[model samples]
Target: VMFFLFSLAFVQGVGSYLIQAGEDGSVTDDERDALLLWFGSVSTCMLTCFRVVTGGDDWGAYYDMLQPTGTINIIIFIFFVMFSEIALLNIVTGVFVENAMKLSQPELATLAFEQRKRDLADAASLRELFHQIDLDQSGKITAREWADIVETNEKLRYRLTVMGLDIK
Candidate 1:
């Protein structure tokens, strides 16, 4: 869907360029109508595309300008709106709802609770290991114990010093 929209954007860019290639940045009359449609239709911004389809802004002028682009382009343009805007969106929304419904509310809550319980247990186990590493029963783990128990890591040694633990 993303690829389709981007490729359509490029095609729309070329189509828009062909129509208003020689004109000024802004148009005043009929060309303005074409520009307005092109701006609203081929916009790179998703929100702008939504605005175009949802009638958040006037799209009648743009649709009218699609006339000179010929029958084939008009058909393609209509299909683009139908497929990309309507059908694809509904399919994605359906998939989301389906996935959400796969797990019941109680099951989801239990999974979350079990994860937190495991995390708390892991944290407590780490605190116990740290206490055991404090060989002298001092409140802090000294550098000597760190060296004896774990491989030397320069960053950890520096962190110990920063925490006011004397290496010696």
Candidate 2:
């Protein structure tokens, strides 16, 4: 009973959050419809999970895997919900952290990306910026700097090219 109610309440929260996302970021008119469908499906699926496990206690004389009463079923459902929620929350957390980092310190992401590229470029003695350019040791960045910070090894070059990176 408590689990069912909790699932209902949690799903309600998700529904509200989805509405807020639509109104906040306001992706586009087209995305609005898809968001609705996705939220609806997720809410329905959660409800199904709650129903499937909540009433399984009386399920006797069945498959070897299923429990005689439904305690096991409920436990299994709870575990599933726990791990699924953890993974889902991690994804949400990642998105939030990315957005927050971008908003709070926009320059950091750019610098980090450039620094990574510079490191990779430097790894093979192909540093994009000359030592003089990095006078402060703060890895100088330039539009054309991206060009030199790349590898031309056939395998890597082909992989990136296949991903539409215009490696050539």
Candidate 3:
């Protein structure tokens, strides 16, 4: 919207310049009228800029009419085209990223829940294994118990090693 307004302003500025130049005898009345036909009023100028920006036709005529305004008009046209394209691309990218984040929210929650379930199951298994090793029912396994179990129980040793314990 801001780009549209700025482009409208550029169109109006060129129109004003051409009209004034015509009044001062630098530009002919016909040339001024031709330019003003598309940019004389705010509504026409806005519509014209919108059409040009959105790839509407008859731009060649407008470009030719703008020639009287020297290179400034050409520069303005180029700037408008580039800025509008960049702004539109940014808008599209932002929308895509926002949607992607929104869509992934449920998946992220599911992943966290699954991880928590696995942790709880692992904790239950470890508690059971600890009880089995605590032969005295002391609620804790002593180092001697751990060493004797690990030496005799290959399965327990492998489980400890897989769990990242320095059982050796």
Candidate 4:
């Protein structure tokens, strides 16, 4: 069931991306191919993680809900959220890169590193990053460490200047 569902999601993601491209404008074959490849890669990664995390417990119920009919609403909801998120990220990345471009290399790297401080708090892949910044570990980062991490850019100074890393 999981395998079939994962396959269906991969096909659906590619189909949606192409339809989206066509709705915006004409998409070249190269663009279509690129979208398929990218979607397939990401789908594979997500499916792997899902399978690992859902090997038991409520897996049957969750898997049962993933039928094409049942999951249609969820798929649309996810598509909108993911699309808007990507668009926002593009905007933010462009703005930040442009702002950082004028700074010296040292300052630019510092700013970029600081920009990633929020990501460091991620309990998944970034746990190691948070640990490195935590200094004393204790499963949390101190205010001074957070300040050090996000002090480069004036914008993020106040946001990350807390008692400890905001781990969830």
Candidate 5:
């Protein structure tokens, strides 16, 4: 199900770019330009597809491609919207709901607990993780050590819920 959505997004992204080629693809006064270069194609395609799917933004570039192409392209666009925007979105929603319904509340709690336990077991001990962060072997973590840890562990930077308590 995820693969289907990913494939659809890729196709739509390419379609969006191809259709909008006449317009400046660069960031201009009115529009934000894409950042970075190498992964831009796949990233922009996915972003454009996501925007179209969610109905957040549409510059009409994709539709504009139809202006010179005539009736056949219009038909193709209709199908693209139907399958990618409507059908795929609805199917993905249904799959999510179906999966949610498969597990009971108690079962979910048990699964969550088990997953947490497994993650903790697989990770380095809290003491060891902190020791690594304290590269100079100082008992206390300085600002540099803290910054180094946060930079290296992206997950920890995002998931720091406890202020006084430390966990790896």
Candidate 6:
């Protein structure tokens, strides 16, 4: 939008200059009227540019009308088309992508938090199982203790199997 407004202003400024630089440092009544009709009001210029940039209106008519004015007008029209359609569109796309990433951040965080909670629960379960297997309250399971517990405890074997540990 800013680029559109700036281009409109530039075209208006050039129109004003051309009007002032006419024959005898002044324009005829008809030419003055035509120039005024083309670049007189900001609202009109803005609507024209908006329509041209959005493809809502035919730009050939505008180009044809301004073609006789000078090369500067044609160049300004090209710049307006390039900046508004290409550059501004890319900027808008970037803003949308950035917003989408921001919106998904909480979901990503939630998934990470749930994964951490499952990991902590698994660790606690493993610790409890380790304590149960550590005979003589030694806080450690010797190979003999592990073998004896696995051989004697069916429930422990089932629990270890459920926990993805092979007792064999």
lDDT of 5: 0.55
Instruction: List ranges where model 4 is wrong by over 4 Å.
Output: 1-69, 104-168
Worst 10 residues of 2 by lDDT: 60-69
Q: Is candidate 1 or candidate 6 better by TM-score?
A: 6
State which candidate has the highest lDDT: 3
The model with the greater lDDT, 2 or 3, is 3
- TM per candidate: 0.38, 0.25, 0.64, 0.21, 0.31, 0.56
Residue pairs that clash (backbone atoms under 3 angstroms), model 6: none
Cα-lDDT of candidate 6: 0.75
What tens-digit string does per-residue lDDT give for candidate 4 at 7-120?
A: 566557557656766787766776555444434455652553255343423333333332222356346434533554566679899999987885535677687887687456
What are the Cα lDDT values of the candidates? 0.60, 0.49, 0.78, 0.53, 0.55, 0.75
Name the weakest run of 10 consecutive residues (lDDT summed) in model 3.
Answer: 1-10
Clashes of each: 0, 1, 0, 0, 0, 0
Which tens-of-lDDT digit does each residue in 16-35 have in candidate 1?
75467436444345654444
TM-score of 2: 0.25
Model 3 spans > 4 angstroms off: 1-8, 20-33, 57-61, 105-109, 120-144, 150-168
| Local accuracy of candidate 2 as per-residue lDDT tens digits, 1-168 | 544554554445445555666568744554444334322454553555444344533222222222221354446545655665676679899999999987886587788999899667645443432443343565765645434444323554554465455755
- What lDDT tens digits, residue by residue, belong to model 5 across residues 1-168? 533455354445435654565375433322223311211355544565456556765626655533333455456555656667767778899999988887534577788999899668545555666776788887889987888788788666444543234444
Model 6, position 159, has a per-residue lDDT of 79
Ranking by lDDT: 3, 6, 1, 5, 4, 2
Residue 70 alpha-carbon offset, candidate 6, angstroms: 0.9
